[model samples]
Target: MSANLLPSPMSDPIEFNNSIDLSDIGGTLTLAETTHDAWLPPEPVNTFEWLCENMHSHKGAPFNPVQFPWTKGICEAWDDPRTRNIWVKMGSRLGKTEVSLGCHACAQRHDPNTGMIGASTQRLLEKTIGDRFYGMMAKTPALADLCPPKHRQNSHKVSTRTFITYGAWSGSPTTLGDIDPKYVNLLEVSKWVREQKSESDSIELALARGSEIPDRKFLGESTPTIKGACRITKFVERASNEYFHVPCPHCNHHQRLRRNTTGERKDGGLMWDGGPEEAISPEKAYQTAHYVCESCHKNIDETQRRSMIQKGVWCGTGQRVDKNGELVGKPANGIRERSFNLSRMYGWTFTFADYARAYIESLSLSGQSFANDWEGEAWVPLKVEMEWEQLAKRLCVGDWELGQVPEGCYFLTCAVDVQVDHFVCATFGWDNRQRGCLIRHGTVDTWDQVREWIQRPYEALDGGSDMRARMTLIDSRDGNRKDEIINFCRSVNDEAGPHVYPSMGGNHGSMNLRFFRKLAIDADNEIGKKAKRNIVPGIHLIMINTTVFQEWMDNVMVNRVPGDDMSMMLPQCLIEDQDLFDQLLNEKLNKEKGIWEHIDTLVPNDMRDVFRYGRCAAEVLTNGNWARIPKHRPRQLPESEADRHQRQRRTAEQLNRNRESGGKPNQSKKRFVRRPSSTSSKRFVRRKSL
Candidate 1:
């Protein structure tokens, strides 16, 4: 969408868009014919109402401020006479950019005599207009004239009888200028430099530009980054620290949603399950995702997200909500500084499955990005290490053969750690809780044998049933035989299902929080340089966060018993295999470089690498749902056509009118009302693309 497709500021739909004739359609709806309603600011009003009525979004539609209940709290806070500083630490796609612009527009409507926006860099600061700010102004007839020149691009200033705004980035005080602005909006503060060229910090410099007027307001927001280094973290820590509270549709109990805290709260954050142990697929994992209520512990489907959010209220830390949904205590920071923390858990459009995808993608690295990007929390990177002797102690001594499955095993996974000369393979059988039994470990000299080994079923220690590998993950990180590894995996997958896959030991290039990402094969790599490439469609390499499994092994798995979730079990045969034990301790983390390296260069760490591979293979099948995955996954119905159409419908003139007038409905109580037409000739702006 561009500036030209923006909603017209005209109050009358006919005058706004003469292209469509509603008279011909009557009261019915159709595909070819749709609503062309437009809206504009009528007078000084509540910022939330103003945005919902007049402001156009980046999608070139009227704003839906109610989409996320948390957003409304921020918008309404702008009008609060008590608060001066309002901050929100937000997750991605939570409408931080739109809300920021709406507040600026609101400031322009009321106290917009002077305003400033500060960002991490000049590049980000200058993109405000091209991003959506200019389109927002150009869409409203009243604001279209108050701002934006002939086109809506990099608009610097909006000078009117009431408002003026200046763009500022990280720099000296000169960037803010000599004039004191009544409103200041600072974005991406986590990425901002701590200090400007002058003695004051970046945030202080931005806030210092605010006038000494009693009701002057400053807005700041960012997706939190590092734990100790984040600027937004510092700002939020000092404020009221508000959290969004929503009532459980089942229990009617209002509570804060803290993720993965089953024991601490009834709701266990975002919940999902892979199907049965043998049939789990990453593609199918998201379909079962849903939120678990903290109070009732019942599943909260995505359909309930909007309604629960609509009734949400902001409660500061240390404040609780009673059965009546009233705050039990005064706000932590009172009216001086109001702060909020928002995440996908509270978003209208987010599903539990969306987070399941993030969890899958985060398997290759430390799962901090999930906390930082989706949970709206700062993450502290862990410095992990493990001892070989300690891991050997957790080895389960059993009558099981080195090449056979254990007693309670349900499925098998094999991992091939490719070396320059040969492939070190480890076959592991897993229970539902991811407690592993190392079925076999050794070297395979040829690809033919490796392929046969992965397909063969191993006898169980209990002599019950034999199981073939559910998934075989082969390390393809080395450049030496990367092409061979990928080709072999692709051919095997083509022959069967996606049981065999080439694996990389790192974060996915796209996102950091997932356990694995089905990444596109690089068409320009050394392997792709060959002219005889037989790239299969829909066949991609799986980049597993080997570090996640590695860290779990070091910090949790190796220390726990077999009954503990995600614990590892080595066969008694490995007790005599001292070479495997030594190999496990070969790599240690280099704290200074943040990379793992061989403790002794001479020791072959194939067993260690293969151990990591087998665990990653388990994750490829399980997708990180080892803890508390629901057993029975019920099939859900496809969304109804009527619901889809209604969800996608634009704001009608009636709703816009009610919002524009602050919801003072006419005496008739009818669905439609007549209003006089105006000939402003206000044209729609194109949807601004940044």
Candidate 2:
């Protein structure tokens, strides 16, 4: 949809676009002629005549002349005889409310005798779909004109009514089953699916209600959350080609897009801006180039993608032709699906300004109220400053995998967390020989800094042998930084000399509390139990174990001075010859109590966690006696006499058996009865072997 097509503040629909041939978009009948007489009552040529000029009885509202074009498109889809279901997948601020509101208006207009249902995950529904759309009938004069006099007895119908009828309107996710409706509008179907079917739930019941209505239409709409979780993903998978296929520019190939197919490039990269430049265009040109056809292997371009796709109709490989002169598939009586990003709907014209504006718009007071009503349905909150920083930090460190390598050379991992505006990264280096028993660490706030640290390790290590280096873990925790990490790793991996391996390592990475503790304990006992499992034994490496390292860290904490505030620990720790503490204090403000009221509190970074964990592993692996000894028990197990007696008994029995049988005896089954032999001074009597 172009900016020109945006819904105006006024309620009237824009001019009819007869210029658009429904044939191109695959509509069965141009909106006017498609619906059966049962669905669409004959258009009232003169409203005064239809109601006998009774203006006072109806909500005292005159019909608005212009029609809502967006609503018309949506309603047309709803009324289409071939469409059993429709899924509207969109993003924020694209006039989606009108689509639902218009459908409601149309449904009410068709059958004052029939009931229609609008549902959301919660009665509040994640977004303002129900609230906004329900309000539209009263707020928008055009929609108000469609309601029967009985449905709106007074001007304040929405306020007084429990339903969108003559009765009071009471809408709730819980009450959907009470008032059975003809047309069911399930907002955020995917969310409803998730909640209702969370564990051992019967979500299929909710999803299946519309199908039970004799010839009911089900409309589902939502902005995608995760890839597979969205109801739209399922819809798109089964949607007809006429409804989804977009044309390629050069060869005129039609491509049906689902989750993975849309905007894909021939070189196994994204056709959009974020992916790698294809072989055809390395200059970073935004224009669509030759697209190898997914079906025919023919080359295509942007022009073709537009020409082959139809907006409203569906198609398939060998399905029968519909009345619209396009290949059509079975009308899905069940769930019909379609999904596209808000950017794609707007012709992919998103700019940073647009993103920022959206970010801000979502935070306004009204937006916050709306969000709360929708169960805080916003995927990314606009008031995400703290969250953004946290995300940035996580992104910087999510997938950084560290390993103990060999020699003086160590493997280093670095990553940057990205937020709306800032990024942070921590770097880790491990010795290869001791399987990351020893680790060196650093932290930087930028990708360039990480790159520098990754490259600089070569200078610190001696000889060309150091060039062999172990794995270099990286945090690709954030989706935004996946390309950044992948590209960085690719470049580093491509370089000569030391190999840089990129693995995901973070607080949530494979290196957990247990691994860290093991690392710490392994430091003293080089051949400790933990080392036997994950680490190659007897290698020299620098790896921090988390458990023992945490113990070491507990000693590092400084209490505030007596009669001092809790805001003075950082500077004290920093000034106390701890480089890590100094770095942390410098990075943040002092906020601890006691004598160190003026000093900053030392906090753990991604590196700190890694260091501690590595230390634990090291302590455990190097000195099992010291590291493995439980603090409370603190003792070794002594072998009991029973162990020696059992060994001796087994050996003597074997020798006696061998002597009796001349070292070979055939197995035999025999039954024997023995009488207890009495001994003068013994707890038991021994019997000789027969």
Candidate 3:
């Protein structure tokens, strides 16, 4: 249960075997026996057997003993005194939380008086460790049996034990200061310690409180965050002081190994392509796999590396010694088990198929899956397929109107779609109040032409207008186009009247339906209110999916079965989305329901981008900072029948008052006068001012 205390009953009689197998020994050995025989048991000892034998619990017990196989790393850590902290950077579905819980339970069983702590992210601690893990304590007979009744205390907020009277405490990191722990189990170390952004992280709090408890230990484990500048890196640096040295086979010289910086070759060259392939099998030779040596330019054999290696435990800034008694720089603390460690335990006897089954069942229950619904197969095996076509007509429209040139038009916006060779530019015009069509040019604008187009109004304008361009929205989705687009937008800042805005919503012709919902709504609303202007002022342009739109118009099926004629019946011209089209084609028709159900639910990449872009545009348009003119305010008509009658009554009152006070009733003096219209068609008469 505790690090220093080993169960004697199971370990003392452990057979000396290099295989370290823990199998076929059930429910007999006691803790005292394990402690007696655990002193550096040689290979074939079946460490797995010894562990399982020691872990055998009484039948019909209130609790089940934590019965997972003891990893080599955990066993090695138990032996090393220098390794005050063991950091496990594991992958997903590795039972990290179970490891923490089982380790605590194991420690409790071994040493009833030893103290320990369990810490994780506050949210995880509450929802998972407290809620889920504690729930197991009640359900697991082995765990209940192992936990003495007096020591166990369960509650809604927490479930605690005093196994080794005040030896360990379990809580969130923030609460670590209150629980003085001898051994600390830091759960999800990446998220808890490495990914922390504030001073209040559990690691910091643990360190602060750790000094109070002398002779303390730490276990930090989680799936890696991968990103640099995380707490795991700091932990690695701190733990790097201890070295595990192995003798060189050729020279018989004991030398410590340091984990060299990855990606940089010893020759000062860089790895531009993929790094070394992952080692899938632990029994496979490690040296022969992908490692390179800087000393002799020779690769070491894996079998030899495994034979000569000792899992060395290191502490702070410790030095190493060679066979000649010469001092060497500090090296990495050699890991006994790494990525492939889990592969070894999969088929072992101690590996309960039931546990694995439960884990898989939990994942399915949580609505998690590794497979794609389409093809009824794994998602990772999903394939990419593409089709390309060109159409003469533009699929999307610009904002500018060529037939009617409105006066006092000041702002214009451009949306430029960048291709490998040429860019497609669509422009829109707005007067800070109303929006209209501007101009659209495709695959024709050279970089210079684009520059001029963005800087000033189109030369093809119907009137000789002097108003300069307002805003230009350029596309920069491609990493290659970023520099050019950014430079172009920056260059025309002073020349253009409006800001150069970069737009990222359109998905070219690749299933992009950026404004599908927004465009479908009728513009009409409450007429009494002033027109709501688009907040993101300037031209609204998007890369027209002319090909996809045409395909939709033609009701053409993309990769659909020839026998499936449902989507074929729908006209393609009105459909704006190819992803939707493809999705609909895969639906299964139920005659009884008279409806089609999707055969597979999958989120397409194009749809994701489209949603992202739509969200970005929505944020910009509805941010509530539209410009308004004080003097040229538009007249608002009243709403509601009662309000209209009230206005007419007020108008009558004003006219009667004017008639009573004037020498003669003036016909020109009318209340609530309407202004003259500018359009050529005199559709409505205007009343004179009162």
Judging by lDDT against the true structure, name the best candidate. Answer: 1
Which digits, one per residue and each the tens of the lDDT, describe model 3 over residues 1-690? 213233477566544333332344432333455454455542223222233444322222232123233244454463354545565543344444555554555554444334444444445555544444455544454455544343444321333453431221233434565665655666655444332455565566665555455345566665433234234434644554233344555554544433233545462111122333221111222212333344443444444544444322222244555555355664344432121112111212212222222222212111112111101111111122322211111222222333222343344445555667766654543433222233333344466666545544343233443334454556666756654564444434423235554444322112222222121101121111232332222223233232222222222223222122111122123235354334323433232222224445662223222222322322244231234423232333435578656755864564455345531222433344323445646644566444
Q: What is the C-alpha RMSD of each candidate to the true structure, in Å?
A: 21.5, 28.5, 24.5
lDDT (tens digit, per residue) of candidate 2 on 1-690: 222323466867555432334454454343443333333334423322222222121234432212111233345556665566666655544444445544545555444333443433333342233345344454555455553344434321222222352111122334444444556665544444333323322234344554656556666665443333334545644653223344444344444432123455443212334342122222233333233555555554444333333332333434444334454555443224322222232222332223322322222112322221121132222111222232223222212223222233233333333334443443333332222212234446655455455544332222222222233444344556554555554444444323332233222112322222222112222323444323322222233322223323322232212112111111111122344443322222111100112122454354344443333333333332222322231222443568646755764565465456543323322344233334445534344465
TM-score of 1: 0.57
Q: Rank the candidates by lDDT, best first.
A: 1, 3, 2
Greater TM-score among 1 and 3 belongs to 1
> How big is the RMSD of model 2?
28.5
**Model 1 lDDT per residue over 50-167, tens place:** 7777888755787776775577789878878788888889887788878988888877765446788777777777677556677677776547667546553444555554566777
Candidate lDDT values, in order = 0.68, 0.36, 0.38
Per TM-score, the best of the predicted structures is 1
The clash count for each model shown is: 25, 119, 69
Worst 10 residues of 2 by lDDT: 589-598
Please give each candidate's TM-score: 0.57, 0.36, 0.33
Ranking by TM-score: 1, 2, 3
Per-residue error for 599 in candidate 3, Å, reads: 43
